[model samples]
Target: MEVRRATVDDIDVMAHVLATVAEEGTLGTEPPVDLEVRGQRFRELIEGQGPSAMWVLEDGGRVLGNASVSETRTSGVLTLGMAILAEARGRGGGRRLLEAILEHARSQGAHKVELEAWTDNARAIALYVSTGFEVEGLRRNHYRRRDGSLRSTLLMAVLLDTSEPEPA
Candidate 1:
């Protein structure tokens, strides 16, 4: 599998992977993903000149999953999210994707990268932790699902700016 910066040609497959993963109720987004809106967003990130960027993992030239870091309201902080097809989860794709985005974040001068993962997503959390991410906090009953049930998430982050402050 190859992990690379995504282009306009990858939007559809990326959205498809997202929607497929969402159907399992693991990701933040729900099924029935709005392709047009998602495509537009991907287009902006790909075509625009900004710190935010997206990447995809492909095997035999077919996309298997995607990850992205978007500029957050706080400067120097980027929010990250990723989704991989269920069949592709066990392989090292997630790690590779995370590596790519984290490198991109550092290159863009981002101070930190943050993400939210469902509390039940133990595998994902483990992967994040192994990659230097720390569990920051948990948002209890934070998100209400379409069926009216609530889901909580664990807020995790990795600080990129670990340098010592200048002495006065």
Candidate 2:
């Protein structure tokens, strides 16, 4: 699979990937919406041109996952989110995406990257920890699953050390 910066042309397939995972109730906090609507929203994100970047994993002309980091109102802090298709999980796609996001954030001068994972998502939590993220805290009952059960969320972050001199 190839991971690269996402463009507006990728919105449709990326939306489908996200919608599928959202339906599985694992990748997003919001309920799954219509595929076309999601695509439109993704288009807006691409055109918004804010302090954010998005990347996608593609293979054989199909998008398998996407990652994004959007700057929050808080200075020097960015919020990260990523999702890989169920079929693509457990094969390092998530890791690659997170690493790319972190690298991009550092280049953009972000001081820290933060994300929230469902407390029950052990795989994702472990991945974050392995990638140098620390669990900052937990938000009790922060998410409601499709089955109407509430789930807690773990707040995790990694601080970037940007003090080193740039290469000449």
Q: Would you list the C-alpha lDDT of every candidate in the order shown?
A: 0.91, 0.83
lDDT of 1 by residue, 1-168 (tens): 989999999998888788888889998998788988888988888887778899999999989999988886788999998998988888999999999999999999998999999999999999999999999999999999999999999999999998966588
User: What shift in Å separates residue 164 of candidate 1 from its native position after superposition?
Assistant: 4.3
**Over 4 Å off, model 2:** 145-147, 162-168
What TM-score, computed on C-alpha atoms, does each candidate reach? Answer: 0.95, 0.87
Candidate number of the best lDDT: 1
Q: List the residue pairs that clash in candidate 2.
A: none
Error of 1 at 106 (Å): 0.8
Model 1, runs deviating above 4 Å: 164-168
Say which candidate scores most in TM-score. Answer: 1
Which residue pairs collide, candidate 1? none
